[model samples]
Target chain A: MGLLLTEDEKMLQESAAGFFADKAPVSQIRALRDDRDATGYSKELWLEMSEMGFTGVLVDAENGGFDMGFMAAGLIAEQMGKNLSASPFLSSSVLAATALKMAGDKQAAKLLPEIVSGKMVMALAVDEGGKHNPDAIQMTASPSGNGFKLNGKKSMVVDGHMADQIIVVAQTDDGLTLFVVPTDAKGLDTERTIMVDSRNAARMVFEDVEVTGEQVLGEVGKGADILNTVLNAGRAVLAAEMLGAASQVFQTTNDYLKERKQFGKIIGEFQALQHRMAHLYCELELARTSVLTALTALDKNPKSAGPFVSMAKAKLGSVAKLAALESVQLHGGMGMTDELDIGLYLKRIRVAQELLGDADYHIAQITK
Target chain B: MSDLEQFRAETCAWLGANCPEEMRTPMKRETDGCWGGRNWVFQSEAQKLWLERMAAKGWTAPSWPKQYGGAGLSRAEDKILKQEMKRINARPPLLSFGIWMLGPALLKFGTEAQKMRFLPEICRGEIRWCQGYSEPNAGSDLASLATKCEDKGDHFLVNGSKVWTSYADEADWIFCLVRTDNTGKKHHGISFILFDMETEGVSTKPIKLISGRSPFCETFFENVKVPKENLVGERDKGWTIAKYLLTHEREMIGDSGNLKPVAQMVAELGIIPDAALQAKITELTIDEWAFSQTMSRMLAEAKAGASLGAKSSMLKYYGTELNKRRYEVMMDAAGYDGLEWESERSNDGELARLWLRTKGNSIEGGTSEIQLNIIAKHILELPGT
Candidate 1:
């Protein structure tokens, strides 16, 4: 499956859609909002999903995975978007696996196989502050007597609670550094945080955690270099996923309009309603095109992916947010209900948007 | 390479190897038609040769269906062919409204007989089409036009004056809007009609411009008989057809934006290459990229079967403005040469004609003001003027 998916992908997406509809429905997500310890999604279905290659989508076939690259892995996320499925793929594969690839170390490579097997959980603990911007780093990493002592809180860590390993971002005297700390390591504290999306993220406290000097993921002070490249790829995948999510919101609202009647006719029959739907549809398609072009451009000009990456993030991020908001507003009172699937989309969109730099942040970076 | 990739590579190689050699120039090279716009003189052998070759290959209408004399390539394939053609610096097969506007309309709304008849001829470069729109008073308020088309039972007698009719004097045929009902509201009475330019009562006088080019014409039709079969769609419903045709026309103008801006190209390929000029070129390329994305999105959305109503106006407005900006830059790149009106001394003939003639781009088809109103009413839901 490439920029335009093949027919088999459409069928695969349909099958995934069927699984989500039958098992981990919206009600399950709704019930998990207040339960501090409640992690939603069915484990049996997750195993089934893992069997379907949801776990190691971009992993090499040699690692007991499908070697479909970002494009195919991206489509699954997009379809997962259809139901606002709160899977760990975004945190583990797109973020952590991406960082590992950047480090290109023997340890990171060895960890990939384990991570892909769905037997291990991992997270890239970047973003020292609430900001997703790399420039926001204030965490300190300094040489201790034998190795290194890391001190700083990594805020808004996805899977930070359940992650077996946290790839923490810290600043050294040289520059920004990324360190892989085992979640069980002493002096590390993880506290659960509530998210609008019902997915659990955590605020992590790292107080003088000692690690070997070799525990750093890549070359010292070069974490920003890897972050930019990984984020570029992330931006494209995020765009594809957002496109998928926005598409569902558009569809759900459309379905509701068709089902609910006003003035003795379907509200969709009104020209005013039709034009608003049409305009939003146009924006979604435009965002989709920008994403496809960005991906194609990335394949061609791997060197200049920075601007295009930011462009995709800037365009698709704001557009997806708008799609979610508009879908709810257009749906009227029922759209905001926890029962409807549209609310799930809005919830997930808000969180994922903040996961990356928010729209305005990315847009400001894009002005260059 | 995969078969499709191999096919694409081979196709590009072939186009690169076969594009006409002598026609490649940074200077003004004449076409079969020379006088520009209304008085266009077909004088260049290379232009004629290029057109015949492309039309025969069906590359002229790549996205169009093969049954209607098009290449009928898939969207991806069509995009590849277009990129290859650009890489080869191929001059357009035909830049006429016939290929871009009327042909697409005929394919969509034309009777099967019309498609079988006109599309092949259009594809083969056997027809020359000119738009018969715009009038002195009806320039921006196009729907308020008072041109008359009386139904004479056997045929419709068209009598009116169309101003700024590009290439009306040189064109073989004209597609126009004329009033078939006078008493109804201004917009409802108008009907879109097509007729032969050589009809006895039809004549055109060139409207010369400061650029020594005549892109506009004053067309007068007196009792010109157009066959009833030439009536596109319904008579009173011509507004619908005209509006639909306008979308295709706006899109046509928008799609034309994929070309490198004349000034940008000159800055890169002309005798003078400088850093400041190259920066401008980068800017234009970005605009072109954004515009290309917009047009591509339109096609993709349509293919995906989503209804995209009225956004064509937005495309038209941005595109026409971009085109004007492109031409302005072309004039800037031309420097002192832009002031030279004599065709014999023209630096880049196409560039010269384009720079001067493109002034009407914002004015032609639908005016920029009309587009603003469209966006206001149809898109923004603003109160009517």
Candidate 2:
């Protein structure tokens, strides 16, 4: 429980890393930004990932899944982050799959196959506008005949415009509830929210968006329980990705420090800069261990996943942010340019810091 | 069913039968356990008996060879014994730098005669050891030490001083590094040697630390003679052994940071209602837990024969940082009472003193900055000018 990674797990990580390195590189990430790709990622690479069994990693084997745990998905996310591959893997393959599987309802059965096959993109519309506090949820689901009518906006809905289905968290008479709504449903408005990271998300305004009784995820008034669990999974995956990004950023900066000569010598020769890089390296190791421990904790005790996830998020978010800042600062003028890939990591890290929950938000949740 | 299980059961049975009830409770003060040596005094007969019983069974150095008065258990079996002891809440039978730091080096590099001579005494708690690596001018740059040792054919004349030698005034022997040849590279011309603390001209002066305790000393060797046979490995090759032993020293220092839960500390301090303090406690606790997991992962990797190399620097740096945070939060939880000095209400300011003591944890066993340099050069492979 405390030690070595089994051979199977190691192989799973190796294959994913190899796949990302071969199929998705930083050049491809830059191309997407330069072309202003509407989807913000490649559909062909998504299918290849699905074919590699990554999309179904968390689903039951009976439902076209390999049944690998969140740790496996975390490994995939880590590799994808190294290449800065932008995709719905986090939104659809990880968070959505976790929500559906944890719910274990009829909708999961109906949608699991499509989601696993990469035919359907999914996003979770949970927060209203403020920070990622679950208690700030005020989107209402009012009674309208046989189903509920959804109103209020959900901001920063990751991959919302590209999604065919969106799981919206709304307040109803039964308290917080989750509903699976079709993206193109009546009175639904989706505005593409261009982010600093050049990633795709949408601000969704749900005006009388109707859903049937069967669309409800889990029991009424109990969506918070499922939402928390899904959010823990999201946080863990995010931590893994951040670790990868921080590690890459550290390596990139180290290379720059070695190559960039200043005053007739390499900048890496400077003791102050070396010490700073070393500090960042230690922080990266801490974040790495915290992320792995969080993933293991989730598998060991699903009920007690909150503190571990929060801890991982709090530590990794801070580390990733520091790594991004330090990497940019270490790379000097070249790092400030958009043409350099290091800026891309910095922007992505900044956005990811605020996603799921920022470090401060998570510290509040766990500490208080 | 398994051999380890059988060993665990036997260990449990023996400990239950032998460990005194008073010794089963938590150590309330630093002086609760026996640090065996010539100057050692047992806190109680139970403490003395406990060390005697454990030493008789050669469990003091459980993983050492049986011929050296050790149990000769495998690493897994040794771990089981530790778990069994912890399950019973049994206090450690003994703690000594001899057993922790020097024993491993001796086992690896000592001649057969030297191992037979020194290790059994360490196992039976008959001798105590102190390190002589750091000098005033050579704390982080330890190889630049000016402890000069001249070749006198059968013996060497040692003349120099070592600063920050913990418990040097009470030690039975000193494992020292001295400059054997100043003509070569600072690292190359050094040698590791051992000598009795009672040797003529050897003297110690205790240095009061910020904690107001004199646990460390300034040890001077004025033409003290150490036998040539006491020289470890080859002459002028002690830097390798010094670095090897430093890895263990760093590990030993880091491993002492197993504090109780922060909630338990709050309960003890009687401040369960303050949200600000609670938040600090929670944050520090999470970091400690993460650090523990990392340490365990590293331990497992070490057990699998994977060398940690420069990663030990990472462990030392983070472990000390976490330890400092632990005490800081404890002080914060203790409030005004934590700041009391030399008062009965504050255990004579024990908490405050210990909190200041942790500042030394980063400085000793190589400063955190030195560790960072090692990490940068070795682990991260950052090139130098």
Candidate 3:
């Protein structure tokens, strides 16, 4: 995502782009519209992605990962967004893997290989029902049998129902803590919910779900630090994905304007529309710069990644929202139909704009 | 050692030895800038020493060929020289419109004799130049300029006025666009010519701006005769040269948007209490940083000789917009205290005047609207209506 990419990064981007283009194209996503699958993605395609080592993109080499940095992960995310690929790349590979890595030895040694081999799926349960506050862990983690018992609810958990294990952010007597509770653990319940974007999420209710001492990630009550690190990386990758979606949709709309005629000429001939498209390109390019900067900054120092990551998310969120609106408006009636790919981008972007904190949330975060 | 690093070390040594302490301080006002011309005098002995030392080493115009009184450093080395200069906070030795605008045109389009005659003086800061492109009647529609020049065999007799000529009264020479054969399209028959500001029938009237001081003038050229040798390129074909020169001009204006980070201002202002203002500053800081990174990338691209083409218009619009936003924030940060005028405590209301001056940044190098139109037409390849 830097101005100049290394040959390895370039190759990764190209191969990932090609793979998504062939395997998880928009048509493949559209097929999931009526799919009864609980995961909201293709298992075969996810397996193919794991074969490509995408699942281990952020994990350490000792844990069977490529040991590539956040920028490399961003490259994959961008490509997936371009294809409108429905997968757990973010929920599992990016968010959960980052959490485990930041959680350090004990947790990663046990769970990461299973994730790398595509045998396990992990979902991070951080945001509660209210606003997107990374530190607002209302879920209680009480001491129980030398471990902890979690009791609360997590809403809009991406790929939560399909998660083999969930990293739950909850408050303890000391402060915030993370407990990696098995989805099948007693007193835990997950209800599948279909989002407006046609992806499946879960509202997880934890009724005194007990976790062992070994299940507590990192130092107890230090989950806030771990959550911040994971989410910053997550938000940056999310911004990259949103950029790819916005860029592709912008390109699609521009091409449509050139071809679609109104009155007596191609719609793109209108100076009014041309200016609008030009402005959109500017926003998109600047947003791209923000993404690259966030990725690069996070790679260097995770602690300082908050502001840069928030900038990228806020800027790209606004840009992607603009792209969605303009793409729909520019495409006219066709954009409203589900058959068209433009609406799909709009739906996905509308969802992405909210995930990992929306523009307004991040603007407030950095502003505060 | 890599060639550039070695050159960088040598440049650092030379600049350390030459750049005066007085020159190393941040330029606090417009007068601190060394705009070299006939009327220009060194404000201090240190200023004179610094310029003389740099110009002697042919570094005033680093990348210009050695024959043109330049160091003839490669682009990479030229960048290193800039880095070295900034490392020590070195003020630019010579600032001239001649070096930035007309010199490139002359090197590319002028006769060999013209290059030999004019470039050295420009590089050495002996002759300062002001542009004479925009007339009172032609602004955004610049090609419609009707500044007529009559062909008189031995000379071209010009009779017209140029508006918004920055520092024209103090500039030594003017590179002007004159109407030579306005018999065809509006753009046709335009000739680019050069002449001294002290020529007969030449005069300038300063135009007062909202900034309280006049840096621009209305330059009048009535029956001023310029030698046939002073004409750049071919007569009636100067429009090409004019367009080429505008690219450089736009680029210069676009770069003006790279202001220092707002954190420095916040530091100067002490603790800011308003959360909204703090947020705005943070956002602006990030944007400024990103914009600078974009500029660096563009510069690298330019060094590789890849034409930015109409993308310069994009840069121009964004850069000016950024500059305007910067001043707006600074004024806001100053609160009501920034509204003072001609007071020593407020440094003659410098910040307030600067905020007003930024209004012209967008308008001068083609308005933001015009740049957007250019981007839409050329960069976006949208059909013209």
Candidate 4:
């Protein structure tokens, strides 16, 4: 019932923070982007992360995971966000692992260990349009002999470019169903789309991509529950990351305010800027609690965590947007330049805000 | 079962048996809840009975020491009691400044004699207290307050006026800040003292606000006598105590965010507002959720021994501002009806009056600007100009 992390959770958070700071600071993003890295993230770094058991934060012990929970996973995600670290931890670890565990089919049980070990990368392709509307998915999974034939296009599929397998959401005769399809499956086309944040995604078009009944993540039409569970988990974890990013941006801006002088005094001395920072600090505190509560709720009971997840996502989305905008505005000229890490944060926050669900989307979800 | 669980069961059963059915419903008006005093009259017998029964069990001031007529419950137990009370939608037995503001100060700074005299009465809701801190000359710059208190051998003669003394005319006593000396810093000469509002020279004039209500008053004390034992804490060191009491005040004000959500209020009115207004209400609802969680986290952290010093300012600022916004949306939802003033059907324009009252929320305790300044300078460590 408490929002503050337990002692063990705090220790995990601190260690994760240290790991991200040392191994994958924001400079890592700059390097990968400059090098035009094929994977858009480092595999070796992800392997090390797996060794640290971050990749297994949500997987069960039977599947060779830490079996910690969403709170642990969120803590790791938050650190990754602080460092602007690029990885498929969200796609392969949180999203796919949650979907698989919830499905608990033979294929899921077989793939769970691989995901936990970082030996297999999986991506959940849920969005079929420019905007995120999971329920409006029009991709068809028609009947085929002992299997289904998929026909659809999914845009903005996270880690889709490098995934060993892709969990595709398509409409069946009953309703929406999720299919675990290999990237190399026939009639599947994957085109890497490098987002402004320098993260990896793909425009995926599936034409007559056949998959057996065993490949279905859950029962046909019953996939809505599993899909929602995966989406909510992603939303809550993304909120935690956004919280960390917003906090770091605030710290950086506050530092600049102290160091930068105007009218013969530090700009932080100006009441105008100071009040704005104070207001943002208040918002960040609220967002922090929202994110923490959401993650805790998800760990405690995923079914009832919907409203909490929406609150966290919406609150953090708006707050992070403010933080990014304020960081740029406060930094003045340097903020506009890509040379400073502030712009990188701005781009990444924008991308994350749009991912899973944006403020408006989540607000609609909550109000409806 | 654990001790707390057993205590909770007993408490729930006791409340169900003792709390009157009339008292289980929300207070229809501010006075519907008992604010006990020498001259006070109860609105209903249930109100009086509710106060008496709760006070008899020393549950009115649950966390205070048992010797001081409190139940002496642990924080966990007290929380459970509050939860149980809230579960039944039971109205608070008593609401008084004596319990909220003055009792804490007395417990911390009062001598055993002072504690013995005031604490029991406070716990029993026998005395209603008003604050005498702000003056017309001192609003946010409260240290410059110029209430005179001259020592006259065995007693002190007080002569001064306090503005924004809420419910001063109805209060039985006052916890006042008077200037005992004027030689040192403005903050240094102040002394905290208590006196009966029924003293010959003490008088209060109600001050009408925009809401057309006079919850506040201008309280005057002209050459009033007070015993030397009336003063709490060291002479000329009332500033520290004043600051400490203000933290509690801010926390109390910030907890106002715990009110029913705006959307639910709107829904109760049977008005599904336009899309734009609905969006505003939704945003407010989400913010309220976040703010509630933050309040819980802050309280838990404070209980865990974290200093909530300047952080209280952050809460006060956001909570009050959020409350103001909540009312604005509420008024917007009410539309033309919100403009109704002094009408019987509108409950004497309760919504409009409350909306206007929320405007003072950001102004009272400390102005939102003052809170921001404190947060910026203390919490954020921004440089002073």
Q: Chain B, candidate 3: TM?
A: 0.97
Q: Which 10 consecutive positions of candidate 1 chain B have the poorest summed lDDT?
A: B29-38
Best by TM-score: 4
2 or 3: which has the higher DockQ? 2
- Candidate 1 docking: what grade? incorrect
lDDT of 4 by residue, A285-343 (tens): 99999989999899889999999999899999999999999999999998999899999
Point to the candidate with the largest lDDT: 4
TM-score of 3: 0.95
Candidate 3 local lDDT, residue B134: 88
Model 1's TM-score against the true structure: 0.72
Which one wins by TM-score: 1 or 4? 4
DockQ of each model vs. true complex: 0.09, 0.67, 0.58, 0.85
As for model 3, its CA RMSD to the true structure in angstroms is: 2.2
Give the C-alpha lDDT of model 2: 0.87
User: What clash count does candidate 3 reach?
Assistant: 0
lDDT of 4 by residue, B169-286 (tens): 8999999999999999898989999999988899999999998899999999999999999999998899888988898898889885448889888998889888889889999998
Put down candidate 3 lDDT per residue, A1-368, tens digits, no spaces: 36667789899999999999999998887888866555689999989999999999998988888878899999999998898999998999999999999887677888998788888999999888755777666899999989888999998888997888898899999998888888999999899888887787889999989888888898887888888889998899989999899999998988898798889998898877887888887777778788888998999999988888998898888889999999999899999997799988988998888998998788778776
Mark the regions of model 4 whose C-alpha exceeds 4 Å error after superposition: B304-307
Pick by lDDT: 1 or 3, better one:
3
Write one digit per residue (lDDT tens) for candidate 1, span B7-57. 699778767665566434423432333222334444576666666676677
Regions of candidate 3 where Cα sits further than 4 Å from its true position: A34-37, A104-106, B256-258, B271-273
Q: Which candidate is the best by DockQ?
A: 4
Position A183, candidate 4: lDDT: 100
lDDT of 4: 0.92
Question: How big is the positional error of residue A352 in model 4, measured in Å on the Cα after superposition?
Answer: 0.7
